[model samples]
Target: MDQLAAMATFVRAVDAGSLSAAARAIPSSLTSVSRQISALELHFGTRLLLRTTRQLALTEDGRIFYERARSVLGEMKEIEEALAGNRREPSGRLRVSAPALMGRLLIAPLLGDFLRTFPSLSVDLLLVDRNVDLIEEDVHLALRVGRVADSQLVMRKLGEVQMIHCASPDYLARRGEPQTPSDLAQHDCLVFSDAPGVATWRFGRDAGSGQRVRISGRLWVNSLDALATAADSGTGIVRVPSWQVERQLAEGRLRRLLREHEPAPAPLHALYQPSRLGSAKIRAFVDFLVERWRGSDPLGR
Candidate 1:
């Protein structure tokens, strides 16, 4: 059996969702599609799919093989492109994963311009609040906020965003503004959480001088929008990414506070699975991001 052809056929089946669908896409017969899948299963010595008339599901081994197959196929294509001297222009479907809030706020706005600049390229942006496996999710690149440490993937520094403390005019009016990070203990704070509650807030110019102030709050919420809105409604003061409240700060809905003690700016990064043969699209996008974010800090820390 021709291994590459078989792999291509198996990939098509997974992409198209069924044998018939795959056959239609390949303009080959359903029998041929079945034969390729059978060849793959036999070669791998494992069941690739559990298929019935109505549905198709990949087995555990099948799922693993599929992800590897995709990366292998992509690398092969990139190699071919490089040999053909078509590598200068990025021309393919580039899949990206990013945080929901940052993607929607900072990255999404840049998509149209990037596409326009590279007419041959297409993009798919997947935005979620959690970490995603690039290979498992078929993501070509991930634009992330915060410090990421991963040995398996390649990382590139982009820029940083300030994490600032802010409060509404009414909240400050009622409870009085904090004179120092130490003073936060006397006031209601809008806590951000992944768990049940927050017990402290950290502040400093650097790691050596940093301090965490023990604090209490009436509201403990998980959502960024909700946290900002809570602060805006005079519910409580919050520590949030400065970029998140650009409009609120400008319009005086939320006033910046404790600037002298705000923590060091969080770094932004572009991450991707390592490849011997790199993706032009990934390089182009990363370069675009670096170009856009240079000498800018959420529009101050």
Candidate 2:
């Protein structure tokens, strides 16, 4: 059995979740894929996957090996691409992840230009609100907004995204506009439960310098799109990233409120694992995005 081939097959099977799915991905038969995984397990003298009737789960050892295998495969691919004298051209699969709303409104538009420039490059964009493990998921780059906790990953600050408190004109007319942060308590506030333990809306800098306003609301949502929708329908006032509500504000669907008392702008970042940073494909894609955003008004500052 070819150990390298078996390892590659095993990694694919683990990622695809099933032998049949992995076979289909590699354009091979299920039997062949199964044999490849079995050979890998035999070679290593341990069962890598715990196979059940419904699903395939990884063993602890399998999980560790899977991560290492992915890194090795990525490095191998990079080496082959470099040796082939195709390093100058961005020709490879690039996996990217970003927030759903921001991905659609901001990043999606830029992809067309990127693809045009590098015709041989293929991109898989994962639009999710929740944070994903970049190395574990094999993602090349991730566009993140707000504060990032992972200091190990390489991060490049693209720009700052301002948080704005906005409400529909109709809602303001009926409920009246709030003059200060303290007045928000009396109004129905649309809550975004994306961040945990946010029972009270913390406004301004610190505990003393900033005022912690405990606001109540009937609507609670996890997605920015949903929260923005509720605010547009005049459900209540919502504090969201300015870019998310910029279009609505321009169309008069939403109006900014308490501009002077708004929280500090959250910095947007492009994060990637250190291992993949040197790869031509990864560098080219990130540089392209940075350049594109640098020229735009939203990311320019």
Candidate 3:
């Protein structure tokens, strides 16, 4: 048995909560994953997972083994990466995750340049609006927006994203533009429901001194693209990151409203697990993105 492979499979199953999910992620069959786990259990003469009809739970021994296995696997990866470094070229799959809109508008364009620089490197960009478990998913890096919560992940601030309240010109022409926060109450709003605290929009002079306003909208959508499309179709006013609607504002498709009452800038960060920071692939990718986005107009600042 390939002990390292089995260990990886076991860890993945624990993280994914099922052998089936782990198998799908590794692009293997569920039976194969189960067999790998079973093989590992047999080798140790102990059961690690408490199998059930509904859910898989870790036994007490399994929890201890899981933590130790992760450390061992991480060290092995580190050793292999270190040995590979003598070749003096970045070579590996870089798994990255970012918000959908930013992924589309910003990161996608820069990927070509990145790949060209490191010919041996390949990237798997997972664009989704929700946060991902970096360790469980084996992601090398993540591009995150908004105030980062306290966590074990190491983070570097690339810049801040300025948000603006905007509407299509046609809609503004018909309903009139809002001059202040109070005026938003009278207008139909397009809310990005996926964002945290969607029902209450907050703005302030700085992070601390702020006003929170309860808002209701004619339309609420989860995707940024959907919200942008709604605003373009003149459905209602929408609040979006300034970078996203800059072209629309310039092209006369959209107009910025309530300019005086802007929300606090949401900080954009590149986050990675600390354990992987020394790996050549992770380090190179994070540096590449940070160098590309720093002091630039990714957020129209």
Candidate 4:
């Protein structure tokens, strides 16, 4: 059995969602496709896929093998591309993942120009407010905000995002603005789960002289949009990323407070696997973003 061909066939079956679909894509007979899958299962000593008339589902071992197969295939592609000097003229489907808000507001706006510049390239953008593993998810690159915990991936700094404390004019009028980090205790704060410091707000010019303020709130959620909306309606003051409320602050719908006490800016990064460091698509996109955000503060200076 040709191992690599069998693996490719298995991957195609998973991608196409059925044996018949895979056969159609490969321009081979259904029996040939089934033979490849059967060979792979026999070689592995476990079933890789479960098929019904309607669909194909991966068993637990199948799921694991699929991820490993994808990673192996990606590495093989990179090796072939390197040998062919494809880095100079990137031409493939580049899958990118990014945070939902940033992807929609910042990254998405720039993609059209990049695509126009590189007509040979196509992009698949995935935006969600969560972390994505490059290898596991088959993501070619990612736009990550704040600290990146993955040490294996190579990170390129694009810019920084500011975290701001702000409130609506009505809220300030009724409850008064915080004069210092200490004063936040006397006011109502909108809280969100999974926030960097959900119960403690840290402020400083640098780590050595930082102020830590413990906080409580009447509202708690995981949605940044909802928190901003509540703050707009005079519900409470919120400490959040500036991009979420930049327009509100500019149009007088929200007022920034304790700007001097705001924490250090969160760094934005473009992350990719080290093996993809030589990829033209990754380099081009990262360069475009750095140039686009240079000397510009998304939080409104």
Q: What is the TM-score of each candidate against the true structure?
A: 0.85, 0.78, 0.76, 0.84
Tell me the tens digit of each residue's lDDT in model 4 across 1-301: 9988888888999999999999999979999999999999999999999999868999999989888988888877866665666536877788999887778877898889989988988999999888897888899899888888999999987777788899999999999988998998889899876644448778986866899988877788777788899999999988888887978988999999998888888888889888887777777778777777765656343
Instruction: Record all residue pairs in model 3 with backbone atoms less than 3 Å apart, i.e. clashing.
Output: none
Best by TM-score: 1
What stretches of model 1 exceed 4 Å from their correct place?
A: 17-24, 27-35, 50-57, 78-88, 295-301
Residue lDDT tens for model 3, 1-301: 9999999999999998888889899989989999999999999999999987556899998988898788678657765785676467778778899999899899899999999999999999999987887766667789898877858988988788898888988998899988778788889888887544438877766767777778888888888788888999999989889898888889999988877778778888888777665678777777787788766756787
Worst 10 residues of 4 by lDDT: 292-301
Off by over 4 Å in 4: 16-24, 27-38, 50-57, 82-88, 194-198, 295-301
lDDT (CA) per prediction: 0.83, 0.83, 0.84, 0.85
Strongest candidate by lDDT: 4
Clashing pairs in 2: none
Tens digit per residue, CA lDDT, model 2, 1-301? 9877888988898888888888899989989988988888888888789987557999988989899898778867866665655437878798999988889888899889899998989999999988898867878789898889999888988788877799999999999999999898789888878654436776774446887788776677888889999999989899888877778999999999998787767788889876655666777777887787776665423
Superposed by TM-score, candidate 3 places the C-alpha of residue 63 at a distance from the truth, in angstroms, of 12
TM-score of 4: 0.84
The local distance difference test score of model 3 is: 0.84
Lowest lDDT block of 10, candidate 2:
78-87
